[model samples]
Target: MTYKGIAISHTILFLIVAAFSVEPWYFLMLSVAQILFVPLVLKLVLKDDHLIYYFVIPAVIAVSILQITEDSRIDSLLALIYLLFTFIVAMVGFKRFINRGFTNIEEFAIDMGMMYLFIGGLWFVASVLEIDTGFTPILTWLTGIHFHYSSFLLPVFIGFLGRVYKPASYPWLTAIILISPLVVAIGITFSTLLEFISVLLYMIGIYGFIVLAIKVTYKNGYQKSLIVTSFGALGVTILFSLLYATGNAFGIFGVTIDFMLKFHGFFNCLIFAFVGIVGWSIWTPPARYKKLQFPISKITGKGTVGEKILDDYHINKTYMGLVDDMSIFVDKESLPPMISNFYEQTMHYRLFSTVHWHAWFKPFAALYRLFSSRLQQLNLPFTSREMEMTGDIVAIEDGRTNTRAWIRKIETSTIFIALYSIHTRDEKTFMNISLPLPWSSMVGILALQEQDGKLLLTSKSALASDAGIYLAFRGTIFKLPLEEQFLLEEENKILTAKHEMRIFSIPFLTINYRILLK
Candidate 1:
């Protein structure tokens, strides 16, 4: 008999059994009939291997036995029977009905079987735990017919349609159908107009599928199989719609039918219908056998190896590695000349420089005596001619340098009467310079020196004071692939001479650095 006949007979039998009075003997007899009839029917109608028949017969018997037994202690046994029945039916349908070769059939069967078993097992666990209301009425209906939800019957329906119909011939139509349910579900959950559009799209998808199915049927002679399937689909769709409408119109158990009802229940039926139709088209190619076309290049953009590396490094975190490789240098000869000029020019502007030599006390004393004699002849104040300072360089790098200095100025200074000068990195030029205490307090400067090519830079500032306390700082920066070197001349070099002082304090520090290059 055709699938439609089988479905009708099963439904009628179930209804008859459900309506009649509960009798153990009657159920036993009915169960026996179910166990015997399914194999007989399969043997007569299906042109598959006898192995399927062998497995299916035992599975049906097991399901029947489980259904006939009412002891709660046998619940695990019942669950096992149900799982077995589901597995065997899935195997038979995929292997025999799908006709995608035995390999594909076996794979699909195993995949679907595992999915059904997992779902069923979860439900069984929930039942045992008393976490959920055990098996719904639909599930019980399948059990009554010695079948389970994972039975071969649904797959057969799907496979039969695949063999007969081509519903996914239009890719956009298939996509719309698939996306509609998801959109509707979102809309219902959020209660938005967008969701309503999803519902509309879902309905459109259903209409499209129906139209496609009808067209295929008409074009290929209204074959009995297609006619029966079309009727079954129509019936199922209408039943689902009605159930959803009724549930929404009147709340179940006085609980309002919310987003789930409107989107999931009302719209999902159409979505499932679209899925079935799409599966059909994919499984059974069109008569013309047109190749499936796709733009692989468009999906994946063009990129060479170097381009990819550059893009990845720039776009991601790799640039930090590049920054870590930089180094800095200070042109020592140029620094003293720059400082001498700055002191002379800014002397009229109330700025002065001081140098501290803590390690070379004797040399510093001798130099200080010579400077003092020269200054006395010029009639400058004793403080102006003398300087004392000490500090350590904190951080030095290619782009920037930093230093801290502690300085003490004599009370007899001819310059502004400040006891100390604050040392800081000059912001304007890449250099370290000292300013009087009051001048340093009024302005702050951070000096940075960057060299592209052939550029000698000396930046002095009244602005470096705000950066922090620094006694003295000096550094230079140059790129890789150095070309030439210059010697340090004694006449060109100007050194600062100052008083010697005992080391009073020192602080320990930890430094971390990294280098990167492309």
Candidate 2:
């Protein structure tokens, strides 16, 4: 669904839920809202991407309905169904890890994200079913909230930053971050000593991400603001997390569940989850954005090794609009001899996205879709962004998105492409072939391929052998062999295309579109 669809529907649900909510229901309501907003923020706008909205919108609406009915039996049944859904998503998360191969910083972050989601799901199930694992009712629900909000963002905020910023240089700190959430979960259920250790690790992870945020910067004000607000909120979120966790393990005074709820709930929904998710949705790759605090005299553009290699075709055009009628334009003068065969091929585009090629890649694929939401819509260096919270989309024309001249060649089942994006302005980016290896050390591939009777095309980047030294030098860490698929496909009939990138074989950065040509 479009951004407006998500916004209007959720607003109605929030209002309906609010009307029927009773005292403690307020906490659940807020938590649910935060959960709903989490992906929206991740989507950089209130977008109802299929994976999330299909489950969340229905679940929330059903929740409102059940709450309105206020029947005990129905509530119990809904709780069970909710548990089942949680189990499904958990399974999906597992499949994602296996596909991503767990070797990049983003994958590590994704691993933790899945862990948090699964564990948080369990907590939610327990709270709803009223299954006592030995805590007060308020505490039990609060724990669920903790898992939902804090645990959810543990990976998301870090992962979001990791997507753009170079990896952290501190290995020990990176290890602590990768495992701290698990340790914290285990600490809560198992031992006080472990819990205490987890608390320290937790503080390290939160502060660590904040430091990373400060170290990295963005050209887009939207992304920069999210970096500040999400981390700033997380700084406070962690304090409360530690406070609440310690209270659970060792009766700390003045840190009761009620005390934390009033304070933490607002921040969780508004500042941390809401604000941070909004930022995640507006994410622009760090390489694409300029950096701050760099060595001034010798500073260079943030082009990845891959980007610098493919710079010739990387034209930045100004009029990237769809061809409403047949307007065949090709610069045979600029064409590589290898791809001259398909110069006259012009057809409409039909765009769609699925889980990445492998099952394990789905989770990451979903993330890539969220991160590169705008680029998918217009397959150039995506420069459009949504302002925070107001649902006002701010469009900046940086490239001509319409393909003027298109050509393709396949060798040994590998595809190569070159196309011109026409513009009134002479700016052009010849990027849809193989990436030019930008000034930054990022790796990406731009090509067209056919697999299983289908053609998939676009620029893609997944961290593997290429990013090892760069990630280490930047102080970021993660498992390797990760994939990011920012795709556009055109096999038959209507063509499919996107300005998207997936990390860990998941949707890391994307925007999507369809074209109807005459």
Candidate 3:
């Protein structure tokens, strides 16, 4: 039988088993979530259509075993098996992330959904084992349910929506949703203040999701109705939750646990989980990510070292510029003369730059400076000296990438040996730069933009664009959790540039450069 067929059959068999078991109504309710809802949502979100579907069956059997058995040893063992399956699912998501990098938010949401399943599994195991989670037994079980539906399914549904429609506020709302699960967990465990704040943010994110849902174009009216009802159900549940949180925190308005289970939980499981699953299953969106087709640098080690290194190696030809033609990226008629000349005839210029490390990162930068020269990679100094940067551009024997190695130096020490190339995605050209390391490489894919007589280049980009800083190792490329921007302008008749790097939207480093014609 096909994996999906087998999974459905297994779920049916468990539903029959749960029907006969002497479990409480609440446990039976969880049974439907664990057995039926999880597999359907897993298959929908994953879109794998393979062995991943088979993995769902074992976890289903585990949950079914939990229903009929009272032996703690057996229950714990079964729950642990279920947790193992969730770990495997999380790894699959991590692999997808590595293959695609951080190019699209929808894919990121899907990956996180897959990863969040592990937390649900952990909580399930904790509940089955009766482990102390700083909450009542019933509440602990409810937390497991929260992670399964709210944390896992909610983001996966949002991700599917993002595949078709993302308004301007999508990323910010997505960020809020992505982090809310953990935030809520922390707040409940420690501080009432944090709990109150997280609920409000989570509510905003959900409302924003509902607003975007209204804008999406679905395949059919049935699908649209199901999706709308799904999010709309969530909107009601979230309101109840906000009231509950406020009651617990500030004695404002009280919402009892029993009231939530009847209304909030009932709506979420029946409408949000069930209806949303059926809605997306009717017409699954195509994955927003594809395998990255760009070439990677083959060069390894500390790069060419010592004087006469170029003389010792067979030279193909020296390059006079980073790119052969500025017109490939921009129209020559539109570009400033200095900007055009700097790209096409870069060898005819002299560069002086002053690097500024942000206050928070100075200590780390100082530590890196101690060993950076030995690596001969990005061996930038800690000082803010406007030192001259000298580099020779040599043609690299990379195949279709047509890469050139720019061996740059400051004073006597090597600073950078960047292998520069270019690639096109969605009809836009990107500057591809790779720095070789031991059996690995750090790559930067920068998109180009021209605005008001200046050139802006950045690793941050729109959806489906290959523009990010990535680390490639063992034939796998994954995006670094950081962003970089370079702005070039002819300020007051001299070619000037500002380079900035940010991690989590916070700037940590900046460098200003002045280029002069020789």
Please tell me which predicted candidate would have the highest lDDT against the true structure: 3
* Candidate RMSDs in order: 27.7, 19.2, 2.9
- Best prediction by TM-score: 3
Distance (Å) between predicted and true CA of 66, model 2?
4.3
User: Candidate 1 residues 1-518, lDDT tens each?
Assistant: 43344445544544454444243333333343344434333433243445555555455545444554454676566556645654565455444323322122222322343233333434433433344344453323322321212122232232343444534343344445434434644554455456445545655544554555555543334343343454345434544443443444444323232432333232222233223333332333222211211111101112211112122212211111111111233333444333333222322122123333333354545555565433321112323232322111212111122221212223332221111112222322322233222112111122333232222222221222222122211211111111111111112333222222122112111111111111
Model 3 TM-score (2 dp):
0.91
lDDT of 3 by residue, 149-215 (tens): 8888898999999999878788889999999999999999898889989999999999999999988
lDDT values for all models: 0.33, 0.47, 0.82
lDDT of 1 at 411: 35
Give candidate 3's error at residue 340 in angstroms: 2.7
lDDT of 2 by residue, 159-226 (tens): 65766665645334556776776677677677876787788787886787778887777757777777
**Model 2 residue 15 distance off true place after TM-score fit, in angstroms:** 2.5
C-alpha lDDT of candidate 1 relative to the true structure: 0.33
**Which scores greater on TM-score, model 1 or model 3?**
3
TM-score of each: 0.32, 0.52, 0.91
Residue-level lDDT for 452 in candidate 2: 41
lDDT of 2 at 104: 45
Give the residue spans of candidate 3 off by over 4 A. 1-11, 302-316, 360-364, 400-402, 424-429, 491-493
Model 2 lowest lDDT segment of ten? 386-395
